[model samples]
Target: MKAMVTTGARQMVVREVECPRPASGQVQVKLEYCGICGSDVHYYKDGKVGDHVLDHDIVLGHEVAGMVSEVGEGVTDLKVGDRVALEPGIACGKCIFCKSGHYNLCREMKFFADPPTPGALQEYVVHPADLCFKLPENVSSMEGALVEPLSVGLHAAGTGDVKLGQNVLILGTGCIGLVTLLACKARGAAKIVVVDLYDKRLEFAKKLGATHVINAKKEDVKKRVDEIFNGEGADVVLETAGSVITIAQTPFLTKAGGTIVIVGQSAQSEVSYNFSEVIVKELTIKSIFRYRNSYPVAIAAISSGAIDVKQIVTHEFSFEDSKMGFDTVIEDAENVVKAVIKF
Candidate 1:
């Protein structure tokens, strides 16, 4: 088996590695596709995201979908040749967070592509059987790979309590931001406004059903939002850029009683926000970690045509050329919204 390993900043190599076999209650998947996430690119180019530093080489991918090739002992739910998408995080079931069903925040979790844990960028990966969700007949492997990010969007929307007839505003039109847009639309948002500095991404958002697209580099974002909602700010504001500027501006952009969801993780741990404004308006501030129990919902939505995950994919590369894929994503940020590696 071959795995794409990141040795250092802006460095990636494909090297042969031992293929892993399924352990008890686990299943080995011959991975078919893996999506390149913003966190993956951050680790590749910066060698670290916040405190999670890459001290040694590690495989970089988590949004994965493949077919089961072998099943380990006691794994009766899945068998060989079952098409599945891995949820990527394994938590200790004994923890309070897991016991309470907020396992995404478990104190001890082994998440793929997060430095120490080897990711699914290789030809084969062994994952716990329960974490692998079966894809519906109408969903393709590529769309299955997209389920991870869609789950993040779902979590963000759910956290904000998005509802029909509510005006939603999403900052940043990256993959996560676009998926947030899809999730809002699926939940019957009255109108969605997407803001980004890139024109290509704003265009993509419009095609994905955003009622209004604002180029932050050119348009006055605050004025546009006010105009769209007739002086009242958006009913729900989602900050997906993870930038200090965008996160700090949420209070001004959201309605007095609206909710603000922080979906993206910033490189800096802390940023100054207008707490006084939030207190005065009585706004609800919510934040999401990765996700919990969202893969099944995302899969069902894509399968039923309620969400079109594949439309966000703009580039594809073979597994052998995985390094090129990462390089292209970093160098061509304006054009490549999302890239996937096929095995």
Candidate 2:
């Protein structure tokens, strides 16, 4: 098997490695596609995400989907030749959080590409059968790979409890931001407003069903959002840009008594926010850590033609050109939305 390994900051090389076989209750998948996440770019460019630094050479991919080549003992539901999407995180099933159905918050999670755990950038990956969600016949492998990120959007919108005919304000136009827009739109948001620094991304957001778009670089975000919603503010404000500024702007953009969902992960741990505005508005603020129980929802949404997950792809690269793909993501961040590596 061949894997793309990050040797150091801004360094990646293809290396021959041992192909992993599945154990009992697991399945071996012949990886077909792996999406490059923002965290992957961070690890490739800076070698760390927050405190989870890259201490050694590691495979760098998590958003993945493929066909089952072998099924281990005790794996009855899924069989060989079945296509599936692998949930990257493997949480301890015995934890209190897991028992309570909030498994995404489990403390003993071994998520793929997060430091010590090697990611699924290779040709073959063996994962637990329970974590692997079988894709519907209508879904493609590329779309399967996208289920991972789409799960985040589903979780965010679900957390905010976005209802039909409500207004939404998305504070970013990145892949995650766009997916959140799709999720909100699918939930029947009457007006979806997306804000970003790049005009191209904002245009893409419009094509993805954004009722309105704001380029923060050209105009004032808060002022434009107010104008779009006619000073009433959005019913739900989701911060997916992971910017400290956007995170702080949530309170002001959300409607009184509306919900604010912090979906982005900022690089800086601490951010200055206005608690007075939150108190005056009587707003409900919520946050998500990865996602729990969203894979099925995302897959079903895509399968039902409610969410077009495949439209998010802006670039694709062959497995051998994996380094080039990572470099394109870093250097051409504005142009490239989502880049996938095909095995």
Candidate 3:
């Protein structure tokens, strides 16, 4: 099978690789679509994100969906021809975190797109049958691939414990931020405000159901957030930009007693935050490391017409043009929200 391999910085070469067949308790999926995520772009361009540097050849594309072509000997639940969206992280089910139902933090996890773990960028990928989520009739393989990121939004909203009639602020209009906006609206958020410097992304956020959009490049983020909240401040502030500035302002943009959910990757730097302010406001600061026990809900939401996962995919490229697809996203950050590669 042909796979996109990142040999080095900003380099992706589509080379033939030996396709792994389904092992016992696994399923071989003939992948149809895989979303080129921001992390993939970062790895392709910067060769790293946070502390995990790319030390070897890596295949990066966790947001993937496909059709089952074969099932392993012990697999019972799924069968051949079933459409699926793979929940990329395969956790060690026996870890303390996994036993406590926080498997995303499992000490040993083989997440796709992460270095050293070959991802689903190839024509076929053999994944554990348990992690393959069956897609319904209403959802396409492309939308199915996007269930990964949508799960993050759901988890972020879940951490905030969002309820009906609660005003929410999302700091970033990137893919995760837009999905978070959709998730908040689905959960009955009273008003949604999305902040970003890019106007194109802000427009996408508005289309995804943001009540208000703020351009951090032009307006003071906190000032506009105050105006939107009637000088009181937001009930929930979700920091999804991964920028030091945005992470620092999370507390300032949120109201007393409100929760702040940190959903983006913070590039492995210890950014100074006002912990004293969090103490005084009695704010609940929740952090997310991918998602656990949320893919099914996100898939169901998209399948049932509750959330439009397909809209997030703004660009698409074939498997052979995977390099361009990944490069375009890194270079054209303003226009491309989500880019998918067709296999």
> Largest lDDT belongs to which candidate?
2
| TM-score of model 2 vs. true structure | 0.99
Which pairs of residues collide in model 3? Answer: none
What stretches of model 1 exceed 4 Å from their correct place?
Answer: none
Output the worst ten-in-a-row residue range by lDDT, candidate 3: 263-272
- Residue range 198-300, candidate 2, lDDT tens digits: 9999999999999999888899888988898899799999999999999999999999999999999888989999999999999999998889999999999
lDDT of 1 by residue, 241-327 (tens): 999999999999999988999987776778999999899888999999999999999999999999999999999999988889999
Q: Which digits, one per residue and each the tens of the lDDT, describe model 3 over residues 1-343?
A: 8888898998889888898889999999999999988888888898887777998988888889999999999999999999999999999999899999999999799899886777778899999999999999989999899999999999999888889999999999888998888899999999999999988888889888999999999999888887889887889999999989899999998899999999876765789999988988899998998989998999889978899878888899999999999878978889999999999
Identify the runs in model 2 with alpha carbons over 4 angstroms from their true place.
Answer: none
| Per-candidate TM-score against the hidden true structure | 0.98, 0.99, 0.97
Q: lDDT (0-100) at residue 35 of candidate 1?
A: 98
Model 2, residue pairs in steric clash:
none
The residue pairs that clash in candidate 1, if any, are: none
Query: How would you order the candidates by lDDT, starting with the best?
Result: 2, 1, 3
